[model samples]
Target: MTDEFASLNHFNGARDTPMPQDRLRAIRHGAEALREQLLDDPPVHFARSFDLLRIPYPAWFAFTGVYSQQLLKPHMVHLLARMAVVQYDDFEGRLRTLLFTPADFEAGNETPYFKRLAEKTPKFLHKAIAPVYNTVPQALASCGISPAQVDYITYDHLHTQDLRRWLGTPGLLPNARLLVHRQELASVRGLLPVQAEWYCPHGLDGIAAERIVPFDGSIQLGRGLALVHTPGHTEGNHSLVYRTGDGLRVSSENGVSADSWAPLSSRHDGIRRYAKATGAEVILNGNTQEGSTDQYLSMVLERTLAGTSSSHGFSNVVPSAECSPHWLFPGAPTSHLWGETSFGTPLHA
Candidate 1:
């Protein structure tokens, strides 16, 4: 109602004004420039990486339509959110921190807001162990960094967040801004009040409008990262594109797991047969109302091994580092295991 939803892509330049081909060309040019800079002068490069866990989830939740009809084996298998902390150098040659949601939720006597919300929510989620958080501050401190050093904060989508705790009425990361999709902010109204508890109450309310940067269509984050419009998991769902030394990597929840994104990695005979029959390389994020066709195309935009039997060998955009927060759990299903993590070694200055 803040005129954000009333007008599509109202805040930034908004992508609709330009022709589709022109926009695509601009994106390609920006990507090429960023790639050159990163590989040569390196305006933005991965500094280091760390992970934090929020709440544990069942394996079924990681894949769409898998175990939906009934519980599969490995009932004890658990899944949790892994917050990836990535550092970079901005175009100005200043060190910048970009946190992809450290999750930062807690349990028991740790956090009252989420604890209360959990009590009111359904019993299915209650089965997982209480969340593990509250160490995020110490974790940052150990890195010789503080919230103030952070430049940008984002999530794949606003499925759930405790961001307001650190990003308060005044501020925690004093200089940081929330880079999110305009459609995501617009879609919140349709979800809240009905599914209100899923969101942190007034979490984003106190933050100033300028502190929140919303945009439409495909947009570049600085010179190195591009946030692509891949709307399926959530109405405003987007993916983070980073040009790595290896290739272009994408980070998103559109596919709940690696196997979901790369069906060729699957060992399930049924899935293999289905893939063989349909040639579908992608699967759904399981919780969205958006169709799988769009999700599949989005997956196609992602990168995988070249010339492999399972890969299309066309995309330079590889799936970013993603790991289940509960990969260490005993008796965990094979599907719950992560094939790769976003954790990176230090980049040389």
Candidate 2:
């Protein structure tokens, strides 16, 4: 496994540190329990087309499908399948489709022989493909999750596969709402040539395009508080905010890598502004040395306040950086200093 993949499991041995024991225990317990369930039926299957199917939430909030097959017909299927494995190891197996009709698989075929060949291909190929079909089922058995639990299904970006999976898993998450970004819904509806009805629930909040700007905001969920981060690597990315008795802490998803938080913060103006404005004492990234949450958070807070001028001519105050793309990343530092300037500031005027 690459460093990125192993990073997820890096926090396995840092219990000596003074962190919130309850939250750590909850996450650890959840993962171990899920793993035990998977171990009961070892040696999972991997389908040729749909390499992996992932039902992340047991309550059926989301389902992901990856197409592993390298066939010519389903280009989108192939792309999403590769992404699932390389970018995120969230799914279990792929789906393999057998196209019998020429028109269904291809746009146009002039010759009668080719048309006949398409129809006969399934029969001749059935024997060879039968063994491949069982691979995914067997793999899932090893993974220990029953096929019955999979509520949503994906076929690359094609809606047909999602429909197929949903139909197969009837009565799954009858109450839970389906969530999808407006852009994603539009893209899927436009590309897929299916006649299935699309519905957006009242709970759907279309993501704002300006979310790329980093701002100090909080979203309170049933679990806890999640902080919205504007800059890290991806645009509109956010991180979870959790509080410990010691101080305020933020769990950044892609905020920084394991070695050091300095590099990640070096280029992030929005993070700097947030730290300065909120006076956050701790910042935690997905990849970090265990037990350093408090230390790192302090470092960020110190760095943000350093070299900043206050409106009252106090140099000890935190400096508020401009929330512009140019200063955020991939550019030189701003010529003007941020503080009580001639104009009023949004964070601390």
Candidate 3:
């Protein structure tokens, strides 16, 4: 078995490192659970009984290391594997959808900086490698919906070039809007070193910026609602909130993966507290263990929000750093949701 497969198996707690049947079974089980939960409850606000469907965007590739720097070393193969779930209504209406930013398009492209990185950093060969297994086109095709019909494209923090490629892709809906934090757009313009590559020249075009709408705190896309929760990782990093039949679901795409749904306090205190206060039922991550999502959500919700704890104590308190005008208050959800605010006291409903 390859070292990579072995590592993944070990991480997944499989007895056999190579081709771990246990790991695959666990993954299948989790996928089935997610599908069942999504279908049974329909994770959106359905007033009455309605038909529902989910499209899985499989992970085609990943960077070897964890840190952004390590993953960024090879300029060519920086794209990460991602997936999306599109939910439709009984009338075959596109209610709402969530998708990870497609980052693979930047691989093997001949950008000036990428060329320089390849020439100067020969040691970073692993970084330049593309997905050895699944590819994005195949994953998208698997959804059975032509790419052109896709209505909304929700990205975490994709490089400008990658976003351009995705936007240019034939399958995406032309009028489909791009959702991201306002600060992220500004950060892209500022050319900050930390996010230098993310700022593609394409984003510089006023047209590109025009096509992109700034997600102040929350915005309702065709069928889904998006939330802007900027953690320190990036100035504009945000999470997404979509209403499902079960209740409101929050996708911590950048903050957590599908597998780690531990109570906010146990996994990430700030995010946990924020999600709990906001009444988010499911916490989906960008990545995770096969069974972690079900386990974490089940345990954490039972102990935390569903338990006898006081929701009033930490429920509504927004840290000064994370405040924004559009942030939902109990009674007053924003109408013109845009702009940022200073780190001040919590804004109560």
Q: Quick one: best TM-score, which candidate?
A: 1
Q: Where is model 2 more than 4 Å wrong at Cα?
A: 1-122, 129-131, 135-139, 147-156, 159-162, 167-181, 188-349
> What is the Å distance of residue 272 in model 2 from its true position?
42
- lDDT, candidate 2, equals 0.24
Query: Which is the leading candidate under lDDT?
Result: 1
lDDT of 3 by residue, 1-349 (tens): 1111001111123212355345445444433333333334333332111111111111211111122323122222122233444443322343433344544444424433454544664555434232233344554454444455444566555443455445543424455556667766676667645456434455334345445656553333433343433233354555443434333344333322321233333333433454566554333322222233333332232122111214222221111111112111121111121121111111111
Model 2: per-residue Cα lDDT over 1-349, one tens digit each: 1111111231233333466454345434533442233223322122111222111111010101111111111221100111010011122323211110001112112223333434655667433321122223343344343444332221111221222112212422222222222333454334322112221121113323222111222222212112222222222223322222222223222221111123223233543444455444323331112224433432342223222223322122111111111211222222232221111111100
* lDDT (0 to 1) per candidate: 0.52, 0.24, 0.35
lDDT computed for candidate 3 = 0.35
The TM-score measured for candidate 1 stands at: 0.69
Residue 61 shift from truth in candidate 1, angstroms: 3.9
Q: Model 3, poorest ten-residue lDDT window?
A: 1-10
Model 1 RMSD, rounded to 1 decimal: 7.1
